[model samples]
Target: MTLRADAVGHAFDGEPVFSNVSLAVDPGEVVAVIGPSGAGKTTLLRFLALFERPDEGTVSFDGTDVWDAPESDRLGLRRRVGIVFQEAGLFDADVARNVEYGLRVRRPWSERLGDELAGLLGRNGTNGAVREALDLVGLADDADRSAASLSGGEAQRVSFARAVAYEPDVLLLDEPTSDLDPRNTAVIEDAVDRACDRGIGAVLATHDMNQARRVADRVAVLLDGGVIEVGPAERVFGSPDDERARKFVAGELVY
Candidate 1:
């Protein structure tokens, strides 16, 4: 599935966050939204993930304008997208349990019912997706640890593992690796690659130009309350058509 925003605009109270920003992420593609602080990257991701409604324009899933559709349709669209915030908003549970909760919520009701029945029938009921997800995030050994006990990087990795366990159609990651060490950063990047390989589109919002360069297939530059440029990663970083984008990527522009 694809997630695209067309002329989308949003604001907080009386102040505008962004306006007329258009961007798209195709299946198996990784799109990066890069800008300085207060550029509304997180707000845009929230709208695309179906958590926040846009004030204008549309955020579409595949060919369907989810916001224009019914509330039920909006919920369905939300089920197909996973979001990781700048903060790791994990539940008060152990690592394995947290990941399992993420997976269980996204499963079909029939499958979940079957698992419940299997438990009553004394069956294992699971195929180890949670363990595999933890392993992917390099937190296999910390499965029994509480979320409160994890370090900053470890908590972030656990959050990533939780969101990725169900393999949603789109991943909305907001500064996912901002506080991570290099090793932990690679773990998250590799997990993103694995998900993209399975035809899951990903939107990574970050101010880190190098991180965008390392992970993006396409790049969208948000500035002055709008997307100033959108193009292939090479073109956006190497030779952008927009002057603001050019200076922003070159580190010569100050916010």
Candidate 2:
């Protein structure tokens, strides 16, 4: 799916966070939003996810204006968009349940599909898709484990699996690697690449330029509440045209 933000702007209590911000995520593309802390990266992602309304612009998904769509259509549209938060956001349930959470939310009887679901659950009785999703994220072996028992890395993997299990057209990730070690970070990054391979467009909001360089096809640098520069990842990081972009790349504080 394509996510297009046309001059989107939002604020809280009259304090402007950003204005006239435009962004787009095309099929099979991963666009990274890099900025300093408190630069409105999360806010932008929230707007894209329809969790927040833009006070001064529009957010469109797959050629449909989300803000203008009917309630039923909006609900359907939301089902096709997935958001991976900074934290794993898993419940107290087991690993399998966590991975299949989104599917259960969308289609309560999804387990009635076939043996694949049963296999995921370690038996042919039922509840197998949960296990399959966990397996997809390398957490299959932990299907019976509790969410609270997982390490930060493992929990994040479960979160990724859950988001993808629903097969959303667009994935909005906010600081996806913030709480993981390098190894786990790499695991999640690879999953993200695989998501794009499956024709899911992604918008990742991150504070790490190195991670952006490693995963992003294009990068948009947000400074002082607006997009200062956007282009190929290499050019944005290696040869920025704007001074703000250059300073951000050089490790100086832009805020």
Candidate 3:
């Protein structure tokens, strides 16, 4: 399913964060959001995920108005949309339990959820689906380990697994590789590719221009809480349309 925000706008405490922001993400496409801090990247993502309401505009998922739906309907909408926050979102429970949380939440009637997730995690086989997700993020052998036991990178990978386990149509990522080493970064990069292969639309927010160049099929540069330029990744980075994008991409501005 495709996710889109039409003429989105938001404000907080009488201050305008963003207005008239519009973007669409098609299934199997990877879109990267790049901008300095306080550029409304997080706000926009939260709006798309239906975590926050935009004062104006609408968020549509698969041609349905997700934000305009009732609270009861939003829960089902969330099942098809998964979010990976900058801070790893693992729980204190076991690794398998954390990944199975979304599945159980959406399908409470399933009696074999535990066994199903265990099998999916590859508890009995060498290629458990959970393990594959972890492996994709370079945490190949940490199933039974506690969430607190993982490093920043490992925890992030686990969070990725949890999101992937839901088989969402739209995957939203916020600074997914902010605290990772080179190897783990590569794992995240690969995971993004795999998600696209599975026809999952993705929107990633990052400060890393190089990473965006490597992964984003399309890039949107935000400044002062509005999209200054959005285009093919190569063109956006190689020939920025605005000074904010140019300065940030060139490392002249730090925000």
Candidate 3, residues 122-148, lDDT tens digits: the string is 434323556666666666677788888
Give a tens-digit lDDT track for model 2, residues 168-234: 8899999989989998999899889988998999999998889999999999998987999999999
lDDT of candidates 1 onward, in order: 0.87, 0.85, 0.82
Model 3 spans > 4 angstroms off: 107-129
Best by TM-score: 1
lDDT of 1 by residue, 62-114 (tens): 88999779987777788899888778888898888888777767754345567
Off by over 4 Å in 2: 107-129
Whole-model lDDT, candidate 1?
0.87
Query: How high is each candidate's TM-score?
Result: 0.93, 0.91, 0.88
Root-mean-square deviation (CA) per prediction: 2.0, 3.4, 3.6
